[model samples]
Target: MSLRTLMLICALALPAWAHAAAPKPLYRDPVMDGAADVSIVFDKGRREWVMFYTNRRATQKDPDPADVAWVHATPIGMATSKDGLAWRYGGLAKFPAQCTGQTLWAPELYQEGGVYHMWLTVVPGVFHRWGEPGATARIVHLTSKDLKAWACGDTPDLGSDRVIDASVAKVGDRYRLWYKDERRGSRIVAVESPDLVHWRPLGDGPVVDMAAEGPKVFRFKDRWWMVADAWKGLIVLRSDDAKTWTLQESRLLEQPGRQPTDTAKGQHPDVVVNGGRAFLYYFVHQSNEPQAKADPYYGQRTVIQVAEIKEDGGVLSVDREAPVEQGLVAPK
Candidate 1:
């Protein structure tokens, strides 16, 4: 072949390498800097991936000693990505004020029947401290046609007013929703629904008998996996039947990575399985960094990260230091 033709062929094959690796801190909320509890969904209409996260006011200054309002009265922030590697900050989601409250936390998204559904943790009003009188969190269901202009829907009664961080997955013919029940020692619990509206408790008690929050359940590598933020590290569990789960011996993202803004333990994971590959998107606080030492409030700042999940012999693991090579494949 001629040298000119050979060079043209090589350039054509370079498209894969043309896309950059996933950034160290995949994304950060431009406004608040407290992006947590990410829920990633593919926007079929827009042909991109959308990330919804908790936008905590981590930059708040001169707050009262007892005031926890920085974490409260937050909105669900949005970010969009064309290839799931490079993301841009989209504005906050718009939920009907009449249906939602001042405080919004973890948002879980599921799509069916050409409609998008979100299960959001809502606290009626901002509070001065945690567990203040009448301070309660509940999950509310909302539906949107275009991922904007959400309309209120039914609220599944999981028999708890102190529930948050919802994770939903379809198992068999029914949909299973897993969330943290703070009233039950912050243990992860679940409820099932044939449709998205009505719900019933899944089993006798907590699915994974551990004090964890931000439960994320998904099917990957021919097995059902559940990962939750256990404050120390992410607890991993595997199940043949999405109902009964076996806890893995090792935790993920437990130790700090050498990357910037990822020195602390990862929290609040959201998993996306595409084309037989799974990618984990989690948030990490900068609490252990020198910046936190200079400013006490710097510890409150958090950023989103992406890592490829690996499974071998029925065991799951993630190397946060490795570059993420898998880009999300558009839904068929």
Candidate 2:
């Protein structure tokens, strides 16, 4: 072939690469044998991405099956990443006296008025068993100027006793808190506050009809999006007024084929939107591969992971199989 023709063919073959390299999304926490229910936020003061999750005590054995062991009380886990793809364990998050030794579940984080706000699920006593008929839990709010030293002792119980997995967002002049109130159903409900302190119900009904938990809300593409954990997978909803929501046909992170450890479904996701792009963060159960005679890392473990989110025809989706390499753009 002529030199000019050869050059032309090569350029045409790799045209896309010339513009931008393909994304290779690779991020998973290996430090802890058990890490689940992940939330990621960019700290401007620290200039790093921080991930908070349930730092499960993997060594403590459960009388129940290992599959259900994540239910036990765990200190909130913390990890930081320079870029979105790779992460290092930072250690367990320190809570104030009120939260000390308290079993924590999903952590919802937000920053406003130069202060960091965290809404966490608190179980006062032993987490003998998950969904124990008489077990009670509540959502508490704590604020810190810096994430490290939290002013914790006070318990601002945001109403119902059986509520958990709080996801809050500031909308215009008020803050809206969405959580799963188990007493009503496993369905998610909403309460709004003008100052993030005193909260009142937005309506008398569940935001979602399905039995779901861990509802996370964020604004993207001039609209608000909410993704909730339904135990089966993630259910997506979109809202214009932030009060009334319409369910979308798509369910995200339901399959396990593309992930490194394709053993269990992705649960309790927190979506971070930065620089006009969205990313989904969640944790997967460690694989059930039998441990060999020599290998010790085998068996069940949970690790945090992230995947780039895509939007099509006003619907959002995440590809667990696609490689995501670029760091998430920090929110302005």
Candidate 3:
């Protein structure tokens, strides 16, 4: 082949190379610097990637050591990115106070028929500590035509009052929602919905029999996968049929990474599969670092990070040490 022709062919193939290096510590909440539980969706009208995350009040000055208020009374924060590398803070999401109350976490977003649907973890009121009397968590449904303003919908009966951290994906012709059931040993469970309104338990028991939270389910490599924060590291599970899941031997983001603001374990992930490649977006704390050890409050801060997910012989792996290639292509 002629040199010019060969070069032209190579140049044209560049778009097909789906993997690229993404920015380390991809995003942080500019307001409170406590971004977590990310849900990424492509805004078709705006033609950009939008991240909806929990905006914890980590910047509160000199919080009481015993007080857990910093984690409550949070708003769902938003950020936008054109290429999923450089992100711009977009502030908190707007929801009617009557329906959503003061605390929101783990914004799980799904789009169907041009409407955006969110299954958000809502706390009735702020509390100073965990497990305080009358503290309850429930998942509420909301719908939006544009990503900005949301209208409240029904809160599905998930058989638990302390349910939180929702992850939704369409399985076959039905939609499946998975979340943490804290009342049940903090295990992960599933519920199915036909029209995104009513829901019922997928089976008699939890999908993941381990103590985990922030379960995210996605399809990649022609198989269904679930990744959940197990407090130690993110656990991986695979399934040929989205309904029956088997645990993978290894976990992801369990070990610390050698990056600024990413020295701790990854938590509450959002996986985006684009252009035949899968990327895992997760949040990391600074608690294990030197600075955080000196100042305990520094550990409250968290940052979002992204890494490419690779599969070989049906095993999924991530190299946190390697620079992530930016491979987020716009969805059609």
Q: How close is each model in CA RMSD to the real structure? A: 1.8, 5.0, 3.1
Q: Rate the local accuracy (lDDT) of all candidates.
A: 0.90, 0.74, 0.88
Residues 1-332, model 2: lDDT tens digits: 99999989988886342434223223344554677777777787888888888877654445555344445567888878656665677888888755644678888889887888888888766645567767788887887887787876345555577888989898889989999988887789898889888878899899977899888999998999998887777889999989999998878877764534644577788888877788887767655333422343343466666677888887988877776656664455
Candidate 1 residue runs with Cα over 4 Å from true position:
1-9, 16-18, 63-66
Ten-residue stretch with the least lDDT total in model 3: 15-24
TM-score, structure 2 vs. true = 0.85
Per-model TM-score on C-alpha atoms: 0.95, 0.85, 0.92
Q: After aligning candidate 2 to the native by TM-score, how far in Å is the CA of 153 from where it should be?
A: 7.3
Residue 4 C-alpha lDDT in model 2: 100
Looking at model 1, the pairs that clash are none
Tens digit per residue, CA lDDT, model 1, 1-332: 99999988988887562557998789999998999999999999999999999999988854564578899989999999988899999999999887789999999999988999999999998888877889899999999999988999988898988999899988999999999898998888899999888899989899877799999999988899999999888999999999999999999999999988789888889999988899999999888878888787888888999999999998889999999866887897
lDDT of 2: 0.74
What's the lDDT for candidate 3? 0.88
Clashing pairs in 2: 24-323, 24-324, 25-323, 25-324, 286-301
Per-residue alpha-carbon lDDT of model 3 for 1-332, expressed as tens digits?
99999988888788542444566678888889899999999999999999999999987754477787888989999999877877899977999777788889899999989999999999988898877888889999999988998898998999989999999998878999999988999989998989888898898888877899999999999999999999888999999977788999899988898877789898989999988988889999878768876787888888899888999988889988787655577887
